[model samples]
Target: MTYPPQHAYPASRTPGGRCPVAPSLYGPEPDGNALPAFYEELRREYGPVAPVTVAPGVSAWLVIGHREVLHLTREEADFSHDPRRWSLLREGRVLPESPIMPLVGWRPALLYADGQQHRRMRAAVSEAIARIDGHELRRSVCATAEELIASFAARGEADLVAHYAQKLPSQVIIRLLGLDERTGQQLIWAITGTVAANADSVNASRRMGGILSELVAEKRAHPGDDLTSTLLGHPARLTDEEVLHNLAVMFLAGNHTTVNWISATLRVLLSDPAFRSSLAGGHLTVDDALDLVLWRHPPTQHFPARYATRDLVLGGRPIRAGDMLLLGLAGANQDPAILPPDGAPVVGNRSHLAFGAGPHACPAQDPARLITRTAVDTLHHRLPDLRLSVPESQLTWLRSPWSKGLESLPVRFGPRR
Candidate 1:
């Protein structure tokens, strides 16, 4: 859901990552914790649909209404998921080396395709993910979560971001995709590079693509019941590139979203004394807490590149063919109509845009949530006294327009049992 970070490309490329064409503004650059307020301001001023520069010289519509998000997702015939349909990219307006390139650039994967192509690819991944047994998945998640917590629970303190929050999901995803532990660990760093849109992103992406291709080949020769093997055995007969790309997409998407949500939820639990006391003393449930996080700090504050397939009006604003559309998932969840002063409804309201909607909605959401919730419960149950090790202001967020992640989450806890 998150776009890659915006950093300078090579000097042969634009060091500033700007097109030098006086791009229209999105706002003051998004500093940690400033983005949500900026989104609020945009909604107040521009209503649901607002215009902002995506990258240098590239402007797009940001859809902030809950209904508008559903509308765009539901009205796929008018709005396309295909980045190839983006006129800017088609006309060479977006630079090949631009930081946003890897995020907005077209790949023959499920997230970027439409019509029958989308259906075919989606069916492959969907069926594969659906085959995962819920009970077994939870067991795997618990095993990983427990192992990680055990390693650090005995220590009075640990940076949960590094030792726990980040490790559990990556390892779970690795196990699901049949990646060996070592290779999975290595690839996690590569994904960090690519998601940050660092100058080395190209090399990182190449490394990821290569590793995934190897996994695809391994599954082909000796298929197992794992998701990778399940994909290999699907009826669509996807090419090596398609298989590798889709797998890579699943891995990265899983890591990016899960890591952010876990850390964000932990940040809230530790930083907000009143909210934590209520949840701790049974006045509020964990489901309520997770739901609030899903609404307020969705992993992707500004999702990338849902292009317009044809000229049309949305939220009473004129949107032309090929105009880039960014779904304001974080904003939509707080749309005035749906969210009031206190916040969103607690229990049983599944109306948030965190997992998106429509045909392209995240297929792995159930498993992803199960894994995250399990991880949370494991830590809380094991280390009931866990709390922050540093001041709240000192903890910085990942400074990426496309992402909402804590740079690190340091904490201390009672010694392990």
Candidate 2:
């Protein structure tokens, strides 16, 4: 699966007239897991904008500076959310089946639209999401969290990643979408397979599309009081295709990112003594820990990013038209200029690029935080004695190009009393 050296697709030249080799940003390489350090290295070597390859021969820039990332994501006029602007994909250099395609590939969803069209598409989603009852959503998250924890409480030991963090969000989202349990199970399967971007990614993606299409059709006819029905009836006048894709966006974005956020936050809570003591001693809140994780272990590491709409200079790197730019969310949060002089976590700052910023910024941040907070609070309330089952060193990170998540968070706690 290797390709020629990254120097083959360099964005700029070195002082010696040779192009600097862009490092690979994919695969199970060491950087895939220890991304914060990897990002630091990239920054040291290439400043704010570093050239990197995503898939084999798929070259792009990884924006690592805090300000640069802000500009890249915020200035939609200069960069586009539309993947059709991607030069490599447009010219057929990137294979259709490349694992990254499921993420960066275009759909009719607002996630890929721009300007007026983006505003139109986003209004429907934002309104639909807003229509959700906040108290009810919190209750569902608490009940789901308790139910999930109860399933594993008596076991004394469990992999929280699978048994709790992973299930709670999917189940809650299923309920929000008014999906039957069977359909919900299919949704979970399709989401996991597609986002994991394995050999079956393309097929899994198609399956997800089918599932969303059916849900849209069913909701259109029945028009329940669920999120799907809300989208269908929205005043934005979204077409069936628009509603389908937006629901897909909502479902996909809500589930996986929340899963990672919960898992990573729990990892920090379990492993870091200072965090635990701070929470226990009332110096910090669950919200603080969640914000810290957002900064330090952003759910997605390098976000699938904007395409240069026209030639431009960014962070002093000459970005040609149609060039891809991966938003280094974790890297930007770690930017030296933004950190304290002593390099400590900025406990209360909620301005990190974890959910990104600007028009296409994640519209579900509050819901995600609510879900994650309720899940963490419920688990600890039920099992105050919870502790890691394995040594911290034994925990493994999921080698996802996009996500920063533990593969599992095995823990031991007292049996239900």
- RMSD values for the candidates in order, in angstroms, are 6.2, 4.5
Give the Å error, residue 417, model 2.
5.1
TM per candidate: 0.90, 0.94
Angstrom error of the Cα, residue 80, model 2: value is 0.4
Which candidate leads in lDDT?
Answer: 2
Provide the overall lDDT of each model, using Cα atoms, as 2-decimal numbers: 0.78, 0.83
As for model 1, its CA RMSD to the true structure in angstroms is 6.2
The 10 consecutive residues of candidate 2 with the worst lDDT sum are 1-10
Candidate 1 per-residue lDDT, tens place, 1-417, comes to 221322221111111122343223333356547667777787665667776676556667778888889888877788888888877777877778876666677788998898899999999999999999999989999999888887877778999888888888998888888888898888888777777765677777777777888888988999987988888789998887888888878887888899888888888888888778878899877878888888878887778768777766677565677778888888788788886568635555778999888888889998888888898888888887888988987886665557757888899877865
What is the per-residue lDDT of model 2 for residues 69-111, given as tens digits with 9 covering 90 to 100? 9888788889899999888787887788887788789989898
Candidate 2: Cα lDDT at 17: 20
**Could you give me the TM-score of model 2 versus the true structure?**
0.94
